[model samples]
Target: MSSLLLRHHRPFLAFWFARVFTASGFQMITVAIGWQMYALTGNVLDLGLVGLIEFMPKILFILITGHVADRFDRRKVAALCQGAQGLIALGLLLGSGAGGISREMIFVIAFLLGTARAFEMPTTQALLPNIVPSNLFPAAVAASASAMQAATIVAPALGGLLYALGTHWVYGPAVVLYSCALSLMLSLPARQLPLKQKVSLESLLAGFRFIRSRPAVFGAISMDMCAVLLSGATALLPVFAKDILLTGPWGLGLLRSAPAVGALLMSLWLTRFPIERRVGPVLFTSVAIFGVATIGFGLSTSLWFSLAALVLLGAADMISMVIRSAFVQLQTPDEMRGRVGAVNGLFIGASNQLGDFRAGVSAAWFGTVPAVMIGGVGALVVTGLWIRLFPELAKRDHMHPQPNPQPPSAAA
Candidate 1:
């Protein structure tokens, strides 16, 4: 296995490590931002705003970002995005060191960072299938996911620890990591650009049309968007850590890392033993478990209990993600990958950032615990409704369907 991976997957290995650096840096920056903002304002709504600001670019530029990835050099686009993020982190470092950082400044920087990510997410997603052979794509997804989850598991914890000294400590390291990621992005082999086509309104909306036409794909993607949109509670962790759990930055760090720990382990498992049957059932069931875990986390007062619940939540969500990612990529043709990935990225951004907004606003209105508990319940409700609304999702028997056999043409 080692020999095969080394010989056939060297580019994947480079991509793998690149993800580690990039995701790790991004996660650390996120932790510092959440902690610093909450400390400065003592307001939960501010946290939600950060997510909304970051997510706004996705909505505003979804059409254009997708087109850029589809038309331009994907590696160059990814490298540019990473460089922008590095600059943003460096700015934060300088501001924090000078004791000049404020809530407004954070929000502004978040918007800039979001714009970079809006382009980065789809371009990077579209890059993978091009590098790895189709037969090996599922394994590559699992391997790549494991790398990402591993970075996620450690970075927030490290960020939390570094925050004890100063925000600059966190931001400083994040800038360096982003630089490393940028270098790696440049190292990746270039993908063949999609064939030239007419630029029009129809092209911009193509991704939306493609997703809607496929029932199972639509079901899987929409289910993720709705379920996570409700179940997300990470935005409120600072509140929980300070008020309910009565722990400092270290405990908050552990709380943040718990989910990624679960996710990393699950990714590793998937790499060795890919899902073979009942793909739809597995996807729905895992999401249901995710909801259950979220409720558990919200209701727990003990830090250990909360961490455990989060771990379970992460594991369940990871299972659903691997299935959705592999299925979507396999079904998409190379020419359409960037656009499709863009729409997928939008759903992901909505489920995550908008979900944060939901959690934040709800926490402000209903109090933290009740808001989270209600969201978890809402996730369960959404899952049930999705099963009914998209029965084709429930009927799916494999991780991905076998390609339809094409008939012989006159040329053949």
Candidate 2:
């Protein structure tokens, strides 16, 4: 709200707060799922399977969802997705309360939840550009990223503590949060997306073509995928908290929240001073720092040390994320926003959820510390390779700020 760009934009405020609540809801749900799954199976690979299962919806629906976002009404799509997720969360609550929830059932719910997200994420991501003027978008991305990080900062740790009261404590709040998020999305006045080109394979793939022509976007997105695809160690947090750090579910939540604490602080700073120059080099450097932090986290024995490492990496990731997202959103026209955002979301999903799967599998195969440390080294390698391959991203200097017609006359 302190950002000049968002201070008076009531529509974006509704959007922003919905983001906060939605993220808070998910943080608790994620903690509950990971901890409960691990507790039930006591197998490290089950943690990875959970991540892999959640990622399936994105793979199955990726092509169609983006096309849907571009062709359909984004707000309704987003609102509907939220409503579906709310039902899923409510189902989780009832099943758990009834003592009928099983590991397989949890995986089924994760897939359903992921399907809703696959549609909602790109639509909401595209929704922002419509609500805000073009020139202010970098700062807007910063402010919004801060909202997500802020939610992460409080929710996971709180979710963890609440888990002590049982998952009903976690799932119940999530259902309410999703309801609020759904209401906010619905409150937006109706508007149609630019009519998409007639449905066809070529039209469906336009986003893919647009990105191919833009080396910087492709590089930025692919580099993020390759780097995080190795270093995403969140799937192993339950393992770290229980066996390695010798702490309970609360400790796992704190560990999960640590990175967001750093990301939230860094994003707030970025909001005040949006990236203005040498963005390419800055992006590369941030990812490099991420690699170092991951290695540090891998080597740590104490809980505090692990938290510090996670925080540092989280901050580094905030820099990389803000740069990549702003660059992609600004580079494309509004007509292409949904398509491009869908592809962008795909890369993000691969990096986080698939990365977790990779981490989980590696942890199962090589043991935790070695798997993590190796992943960190792999990130550094990817960074060096990307700099060599995508000189455009490294040498890029400015975001090419666009003109704003006036303060957006968004729904009041």
Candidate 3:
């Protein structure tokens, strides 16, 4: 059982460590940026606009980036992107230190950083399958994803503390962390997938056509997108941290991390027992739980109660993520993984930034409390509607993916 997780998966372990470090440092950068922006402008709109500018370029370029991933060496691509991001971090450090931390500079840095992520996310995701044999891909993905969620749990609190110390100093440490990630990438064994075709518009469109042809895949991605878009509580977090909950930066960090802590715990447990058998039903149920948790969170006044609600929301989200990731990876051929992963990344961007925009707009109209509550309810409604609309999702089952299954004793 332990072998199912560790000994046989050495390369994946390296990848996991690299990703965790990268993600944690990025989270720290995020807090530092938000804090700095608010300090500089004292405007909620500025905070909201940061997400917008970052997401725009990513959403625009993600599919093309995915095509590049499928057609090239994913690991090398990841390295190049990471290297670019490291340079950006250095640029940020210099600019901030030079006292050039203006709104325009922030937007420029955000856009450039987002462009780096646009390429980075898909290649990193597509690279996972080649690291482990096909049979172990699911386990590897779950474990790696758990590590990512764990970073979420760890980074924000650490980031808030570091940001509180000083934004300039926080970026310096983040630069070190990004450099460490780059070194790890450089050390990785070369992982390249067979190229079916040169990267082109036709190839990219074909990838979308492939997704459109598969009802299960399409349904899963669509459902997740809508659910996340509706229940995006992260957008309103700074508001809660500052105004509503009155907990300030420390409270803000804890609140941001609570869901991820729940997700990390859930993903860790899932590695031991696969959630493959009833993936369709599981996804729906998990999403429903996510909605309920969000609603509860919106209604709660006490800090502890709100934290608990977000934690439950995170655990439920993990359930959907494990199944969806495994399903997408299993079904996609290596030649197309990058494109598919890119599409998945686009939905993620939509869920995160567009969702934040939605939350911000709604809050502007209905007040923060009502906006969150409505979004939670909207998530619940979307889940049910998708289940009804996408019957294929309801019928999904994990068939024997390989010719021979290890008996339960031998199973990961």
The lDDT leader among the candidates is 1
Cα deviation at 38, candidate 2, in Å, is 0.4
Give me the overall lDDT of model 1: 0.89
Q: Tell me the lDDT of model 3 at 14.
A: 75
Clashes of each: 0, 0, 0
Q: What are the lDDT figures for the candidates, one per model?
A: 0.89, 0.88, 0.80
User: Which lDDT tens digits does candidate 3 get at residues 318-358?
Assistant: 88877777667778888888888888888888887778777
lDDT of 2 by residue, 1-412 (tens): 4556656677778888888888898888899999999989988888888888888888898789888888888888988998898898899899999998889998998888889988888899988887776676656777788889989989999999999988898999999999999889877765555754888888788889999898888999899989999999999999999999999989999999999999988888887777889888899999999999999999999999999999999999999888788778768877778888888988999999999899988998999999999999999999999999998788888876436579767896
* Candidates in descending lDDT order: 1, 2, 3
lDDT of 3 at 386: 92
TM for candidate 2 is 0.95
**Runs in model 3 lying further than 4 Å from the true structure:** 1-5, 397-412
Task: Give the better candidate number (2 or 3) by lDDT.
Answer: 2
Q: Which should have the higher lDDT, number 1 or number 2?
A: 1
